[model samples]
Target: MPLSEYEQRVLEQMERQLSSDDPKLVNTFQGRASSGLRRWVLVGLGAVVGLTVLVVGAATSNPIVGVLGFIVMFVSAVLAFSPPRRSGPTGVVGPDGTVRRPGTAPKPSRNQSFVQRMEARWERRRDERGR
Candidate 1:
């Protein structure tokens, strides 16, 4: 079923708020897959170079060259498989364009175990939902 008018308005409002909050996140979600493809292309080139060096080293009698080639291959493989890191702060932006840092939740007591903290959080969520 289609959303009612009120629901549509709420969704539009949310979208506006989200765009205002962290535009980079919105852009990331909207971005094309070209960047990932470009990274893979670079990785492929590196791997090919590394493989060539490895072959050349093998043909010659250089152990150091072979080790260097292996290291290059390992680094290329890691870059190919690792996820890209995002730079910059993603803090909330106010209407006047001032960036407001997000507030962190209070940490649980130091004495509490991980499981106990998780359970307490779960209970709080459940209680909130009940109301």
Candidate 2:
């Protein structure tokens, strides 16, 4: 079902808040580089080549060639599973225990329960929308 206008506005507002709060998160998920697909394809090719090399080495009874093939396969598997490095100011936990992101003011520290924290966040959102 299509969202109503109010729901759309709220969704947009939340997105805006997220982007403003942590642009790195938005960038990481956006797939701007288009390298993820290419990386996976290359990894698959490398694995196939490595397997072929391994088979050839085993048939020829060459330990060195087999080792090289194993190394290649290992590296390819590592790269395929490794998480992409994010280059930006990482989040730091303040002395008061609130996470502070780059370029953002530290949130007021409240010794509140999880439910209270969520309620407070919801109240703040409501206040923001009221404006």
Residue-level lDDT tens digits of model 1 in 1-131? 37799989999999999999999888887675577888899999899888888878888979888878888898999998899764456676644566666654455679999999999889877885695
Best by TM-score: 1
lDDT (0 to 1) per candidate: 0.81, 0.82
How do the residues 3-59 of candidate 2 rate in per-residue lDDT, one tens digit apiece?
799999999999999999999989887746767778899999999888888888999
> Candidate 1 at residue 21, lDDT?
100
- For candidate 1, give the lDDT of residue 28: 81
Candidate 2: segments with Cα more than 4 A from true spot: 1-29, 87-131
How many residue pairs clash (N, CA or C atoms closer than 3 angstroms) in each of the candidate models, in the order given? 0, 0
Clash count, predicted structure 1? 0
The lowest-lDDT stretch of 10 consecutive residues in candidate 1 is 98-107
Name the runs in model 1 displaced over 4 angstroms. Answer: 1-9, 12-32, 88-131
Minimal lDDT window, size 10, model 2: 102-111
TM-score of candidate 1 to 2 decimals: 0.51
